[model samples]
Target: MQGEDDLRGLAKIMGFMRAVSIILVIMHLYWFCYGFFAQRQWTLELINKILQNFNKTAGLFSHSLYSKLFAVLLLGLSCLGTKGVKNEKISWKKILIISSIGTVLFFFNSFLLKFPASGATSFYILSTGAGYILLMQAGVWISRLLTTNLMTDVFNNENESFQQETRLLYNEYSVNLPTKFYYHGNWHKGWINVVNPFRATIVLGTPGSGKSYAVVNNYIRQHIEKGFSMYIYDFKFDDLSTIAYNHLLKHSHSYRVKPKFYVINFDDPRRSHRCNPLNPEFMTDISDAYEAAYTIMLNLNRSWIQKQGDFFVESPIILLAAII
Candidate 1:
């Protein structure tokens, strides 16, 4: 309410200011062309005397062109409070472009009017002045045209809205994540497709966010169905292994070569497939023995992988390699 009242008050003041500006412009025009009028005896002596008195008293403002410029300046300032309307065509750039043309024409003709023998001086002055006035009014009209957008929060977030992918892409290794999302009005089905399983995939979610049940299990089942030979490091050994084993068992015919499932569980010896790292058949040199030692030690204590160059870590690994 207060803002609206303020705008109304400003508009009224601006209207008054514009009226004063127009009156000043008219006065300047009359004063400057007074000699032209007097030559034809169009103005009375009494009125001429009053104008002369005004010219003398105005001091620094005596110059007709300067006074007119000041009035034009005031008119521009008054345009600030003009109520604006919504207009699509007339932009600020266009307003400036046409106004600039008018400004040049008005000043050029104004300068030409000063020459005593200048031809068409009256016509030029009238034409340029009218053109300037029309351009200035166009600017005010633009102000009115722009006011319809005075809304506080009329933002369009629609530009950021986009079409979600509903079609699933397929390949030999692409793992599809079933996705359900609401966009616009309807629920759309999509896939968070991972094309290359070799690339590191980081799955992040809060506990109970279905990281295991929804996404992981689907990946295991899909890969098995596609006949991929995958080695899964199940943190919960049985949880993922069971899913992979069952899914693979159901889709065994898909693989061209028969694939075997293996489990290495230290917690329960009966549940694990026991194997010798330094089997005589595979070990041909000391390097094989060293590698077997490195793998065994790293698997026993994973931290040893990063501590390979350390003296204590290297000493134990070398000792194990010698024994093997």
Candidate 2:
């Protein structure tokens, strides 16, 4: 797992380097052209002339043609690089970091060293590096500004009730909530209420599509690290349950207040524990009796409730409620 993570990280870094290199290479080539020929004022006149003199005055090799071609190449590269980054898997954070590093390095090379610009390779290198860094930083800032503007518009367009609810939730939870959320190829914070603040979350996918691994690696991992008690129902091979048990054991050993771990596999009736969900001890009072019944009913009739509506499942729920 560690090796896999390392490889993933390396791949992301390599992608970042590829993106940075594209920008750098284009910038360097543009700088080389400018230094070699754009300095000549005759190049501008030749472009404006539209070859009226025909092949009389050095034709395309003249400074005018060379500079114009270079300019077009520079513009083309800029567009290509921008489009490439948009389609690539590179992250903004990596781009920003690399740009910042390049900017710093070029700043030192240009100002501290006081390098002479006599068409030396080092001079072009420093100049182009600085230019690329500045351009990329501007691009990053513009993208961020646009993203912020879009977010603001979305917030403004949202319903007042939704806004209020969001604010209320934010105010209600001041501390960071741990969650095992995956979004845009990144693992993000998922809200798992440790204090029985139940919120329904469902993960669905075809078999062998990493549904179990995602749950165990992300959600279960967070639960263990945060010391949250869990009632895991592992029906297939119990791989996730085993991983959770190992983590729980380690956590229990580390903490002063040892947490409990249980495996209530009903398949192996002899090995199964004697904890009953229907046990009255699990309920607080008559009010909780309905909830306990509803929980057990939902667990037992998952397929029925899923195929039929909750209204269809209401009868059994009410019956179990009264019986409990």
lDDT of 2 by residue, 198-314 (tens): 464577998899776655456676566665667787877478777888888767654457777777877897767778777778777876877887778778877775654566687
Q: What's the lDDT for all of these models?
A: 0.74, 0.52
TM-scores of the candidates are: 0.48, 0.34
Q: Candidate 2, TM-score vs. the true structure?
A: 0.34
Q: lDDT tens string, model 1, 185-215?
A: 3567787878887797888999889899988
Candidate 2 stretches greater than 4 Å from native: 1-206, 209-215, 218-226, 294-320
Q: List the residue pairs that clash in candidate 2.
A: 43-64, 179-190
Model 1 TM-score relative to the real fold? 0.48
Task: Please name the candidate that would achieve the greatest lDDT relative to the true structure.
Answer: 1
Worst 10 residues of 1 by lDDT: 152-161
Superpose all Cα atoms of candidate 1 onto the true structure and report the RMSD in Å to 1 decimal.
17.6
The list of candidate 1 runs beyond 4 A from truth reads 1-162, 282-285, 295-313
